[model samples]
Structure formats: C-alpha cells, structure tokens
Target: MASNRRAFLAATAVAALAAAPASAAPADPLETTARPRPTTARAALAELLAGNRRYATGGSRHPDEGLLHRHALAAGQHPFAVVIGCIDSRVPPELVFDQGLGDLICIRTAGQVLDEAVLASIQYGVQELHVPLVLVLGHERCGAVAATLDHLRTGAPVPGHLELLVDEIAPAALRTRHLPGDWAEHTMRANTVWVRDAIRADSAFAAATVTAARFDLDTGLISVLP
Candidate 1:
C-alpha cells in the first residue's frame, strides 16, 4: 500500500510537468494572425462587413485610443475609407461601422447633400490620402429626407439654411412624387443614390477610383452600389 501511494504521487507530478509546456507555449501563428491586410476591393468590403457584424451583434471592438497607439498615429493617418452620411445623432459612422480610430474619414450633411465644399473635402481624401473606399450611408425614416419631402410636396417654408438643403435634395423627392406607396421611403433611398452619383459626377477621382467605392444604407448590410 505504501509503494502504491508513492507511485500515484510520482505520476501526478509527471503529469503536471507534461502539461506545463502545453500551457506555456505561445498560440499557433495562424490562430493569432496579425490584423488583416485589405488591399483589394473585395478584401476591404469583407472587412467592413465583419466589423459591422460586430457592431450589430454588440461585440464591438471600440476605438483603441491608448497612449501607445495614439503616439504611433500622431505622425499621420491612413484612413481606410470615407463615410458621407447624415447628421443624425444615432447614425454616427464609427459606431455603426465598429471602426477604431484612424479607420475612417467622415463628412456630415443635413441631407447628405453635396456642394462645392463637400466636393473639395472628398477630393482631398481621394487625391491626397488615397482612401480606398467611400460609403454614402443614409438611414431609414431620415428626418432630413422627411423635411425635404414636406417642403417639396406642400411648399412649406423651412427655416434658415434648411431651405438651401431642401433645394439640394428636392430633385429626388420630385422624381419619386408620383410613386404609389412608401414614396418617402423610396425617395430616401433615391436620395442616397443621388448623393452617390453626385460624388461620382463631381470629381475626376471618382472615375479613377471606379469599382473601389460603394454606397449603401442601414439595412443590416453594406450594399455596394459602385
């Protein structure tokens, strides 16, 4: 009985020693791969969707603004894309896309309307920073779209510079006026397409960056309407 007890203790010790290396060894290289490299359009789009899933599923990898990372990024930034979107509080581009700092260049307009200044900003992103993609994200039941529609359909006088915004967004609303049901919703989507086309039309960079950018809205997916 004494001999058997001693052997059991020795076996247990050996087992623990054997398990130590397994625990101490670093993870598999493939299992712990570095951040993905997105050079191509498909690769870029896939990454955006993957991040969006994390956003929608509440597993967001929030912006990493730690001291080390911030110091590293102080020199310059290489934002992956630019998002031209509405100014709605809930529709923040970073939160919706689950992107971290230095990930995106964002521009906000009341109705995502494009004019000279807006075009210049976009041109800088394209001509200078060489951002790989541009997303025009509009949302469901957008207040700006609703306001524009009201102004066009009823000739209501919207206050201040809002009148100019309405004028810019009026064409889409007018085009969809004769549609049967859900005209506002349809026009909202149309407005998104309009902005996308306006960007493409306004800049030579648009043609140069063809098949690299996309436009979509908050429909649970990043639809690429290039």
Candidate 2:
C-alpha cells in the first residue's frame, strides 16, 4: 500500500510539471499572431546563430517545446533549417542551438559522414520542406576525428562498418596532416568544410546555403570556419 502511494505521488508530480507553462511568449509560428517562418537563407542562419548565442550566454528561451506547440506540430512541420552534426551526446543541434520542435531538421552521424541516403534526406528537406540553411557542425576533440587520425598513424583496420567512417574521413585527415596548428583541429575543420563543399557541388539546392562550423565543447559556442 505504501509503495502504491509513492507511485501515485510520482505520477501526479510529473503531470504537474507538464502542465506548467514554459514561458509567456507565444509559441507557434503557424498561428497568425506568432512570428513568421524564415523564408531566406541569411535569415535562417541568423536565427540559428542567435539561438546559439542564447545557449552560450545562459539566456536560452527554450522556445516551442510546450504541449500546445507539440499539438501544433502534429498536423504539419515546416522547419527553417537543417543541421548535420556528430552523434555526440553533448552536441545535439536542437539543444545546443536552443531550438524546439519544428524549428530544425537534424541529421546526426558518427562523424557527420555522408552516404547516399544522407544526401537524399538533405536534398528532400531543401527541395520539399523549403528549408534554406544547411549547417554542417563539427566539434573539438571529436572521437571520430581522433580515430581517423589514429588510423593514419597506426594503419590498423577498424571494426565492422566503423572502417567506412575512417575511410571517408581519411582524405581530410591526410590533407591537413602537415598544417601548422593541431592536426586534430585541422582535420575536424577541414572535414566539415569538405562535407559542406561536397554537398554544394553535388546538390542543386538553389534555396539552400551550405555552411561549415565547429562547436566548442568547453564554451558551448559554435564558430563558423573560413
């Protein structure tokens, strides 16, 4: 009987937490009075960068994650941008960029490595969903980048399909191996730039503007690479 009561109390507490309001600002962009959807590439980039600023500065509004917003997204979704990032737990694009449901179309991989299916999904988002910005996010101290570098030094084969990732990233790792700064950082940035440029060259996404950026795990900031 005591255990039953404890479970009941826990359930009630969860319900109460869900019922609480997230913020005063209205959530849905589809609503007439709410903010309009981003239509241009530059505007989408600005919104994403601003969201990152909010996250890094401890001012994240946590927009569009409420119950009503979830309900609003059930009928349809029109996200403004697409983020291709690593599969690292700390670098979730939605949380790091401070966006909520329906704000971004995110695709995560072990090293942001590309396959035909990945390219197809991105093309579909730009052509069908009308998302204008495609940001490829690499990060500092990436294990994937490190692993690729290790393979370059040791020449040992990786296990399973992990070898595919090493193969894809090897070119960038090789290209930047002799550069001045940290080889890992150079490879990470170079890999991001290569992915962005590859997408631009292979895709005819007129509305989509591809960019490369690196996430700093320590500072929680994302810097665009030149």
Candidate 3:
C-alpha cells in the first residue's frame, strides 16, 4: 500500500509538470537571429539589374546601409550575390549596382582575373554563403585589357607583378583580335565573358547562376552579355 501511494504521488507530479505551460524556453540563438534573404538566382539578378538602373537614373535607394541593418548583419551576413569585377576606382560594384552593405560579396582584381585567391573567395560565396548569383563585371576602356593588347602588339615586357595582369588578360585580347569593333571594347567584353564561363564551369559554382556584363563608363549603364 505504501509503494502504491508513492507511485501515485510521482505520477501526479509528472502529470502536473506536463500540463504546465512550457515556460517559453529561452529563445534559440539560431531561431531568434535574422533569417537569411530568400532569393533565387534569377530574382537576385533582377534585383541587381534594377538597382543598377536606379543608379544610372540618379535615383538610387541605397537600401540596407542604415544602423539597424548594419547591426543585424553584425550577427551574420546573407548577401544575395557575388560580384567579380575590376579593381577600377570608377567601377565600384556597390555603387554601380546601387546595393548597400551586406547586399553583395565583391571580389575584385585588375581585369577581374581569377587567381587562386579570387577563385577561393568566389567559391566561399557560392558554396558557404549560398549567394544565388555570380556576376563577372568588366568595364569599358579597361586599362588591364588595353595594357594586355599593347603588350601583345608591342611584345614589350610589363614591369613586375603588373606583367601577371597583362599575361592573364592576353588570351582574351588575342581571341577578340579579329572581331570588328574597337580593340579595347571588344577585349573588355570578351574578358568578362571568359571569366564568366570559367566560373560557370567550376564544379564548386555548379549550383549558382553565373553571368557576365560590361559597364559603360559614359552612360553608367550595365549591359548583360549573351
């Protein structure tokens, strides 16, 4: 009789505990944190292009640059795209796309060349960050392409590590030589396309959408290439 009473008391306590409201468990860190941006590659591409259009029209919204957004991103980043662009001062990816902080993972090199470091950065954006889109952006009258063309035409050696840049861009210059446009412009577009194709072919970037475009200096317009 004593054991039965003890068992009954234990059952009552357990039932009461079960019936009691779950004291809202401390908020889970992962659940409480800001959710990542939900976007598809096509959507991300469209958003970027729209931002570029706004910037070109002098109507940039400059979204997500405020204090609250910055603080939220301090906890974690959820950029939607990875932009591989030139190191040109005139062609800042953030400004050109009119995107604000945490909008893009930008990887820049002269002529947008992809060495091991650049490739690894891009892979991180695609594989880890899950950025939906990768954009290879080149600009008109790119000095890198021009220098490569000059070097190819003159066979003169470029000084120091600058020659590395010329070497990387030379293939594109050579490939576009027979095309019927201004050499620099043709090579610029070709270089963008070449890099885009290279990124697209990477197994690491297989899940991400990759594309190329050229930024027009005079018009401030970005033209997506075929």
TM-score of each: 0.76, 0.84, 0.83
For residues 45-128, write the lDDT of model 3, one tens digit per residue.
888888899989999877767655777788998899999999999999999998888889999999999899999999999989
| CA deviation > 4 Å runs, candidate 2 | 1-33
What TM-score does structure 2 among the candidates reach? Answer: 0.84
Q: What does candidate 1's lDDT look like per residue over 91-178, in tens digits?
A: 7878877776677788999778887887788778777887767678777777888888878778878999888888887888889889
Ranking 2 against 3 by TM-score, winner: 2
**153: Cα error in model 3, Å:** 1.8
- Which is superior by lDDT, 1 or 3? 3
Pick the TM-score winner.
2
**What is the full ranking by TM-score, best candidate first?**
2, 3, 1
Tell me, by lDDT, which candidate is best: 2
lDDT of 2 by residue, 82-154 (tens): 9999999999999899888899999999889999888988988999998999999999999999999998899
Q: Each prediction's Cα lDDT score?
A: 0.71, 0.89, 0.88
Better of 1 and 2 by TM-score: 2
How many Å off is the CA of 63 in candidate 2?
0.3
Comparing candidate 2 with candidate 3, which one achieves the higher lDDT?
Answer: 2
By descending lDDT, how would the candidates be arranged?
A: 2, 3, 1
In candidate 3, which residue ranges exceed 4 Å CA deviation? 1-38
Worst 10 residues of 1 by lDDT: 207-216
lDDT comparing candidate 1 with the true structure: 0.71
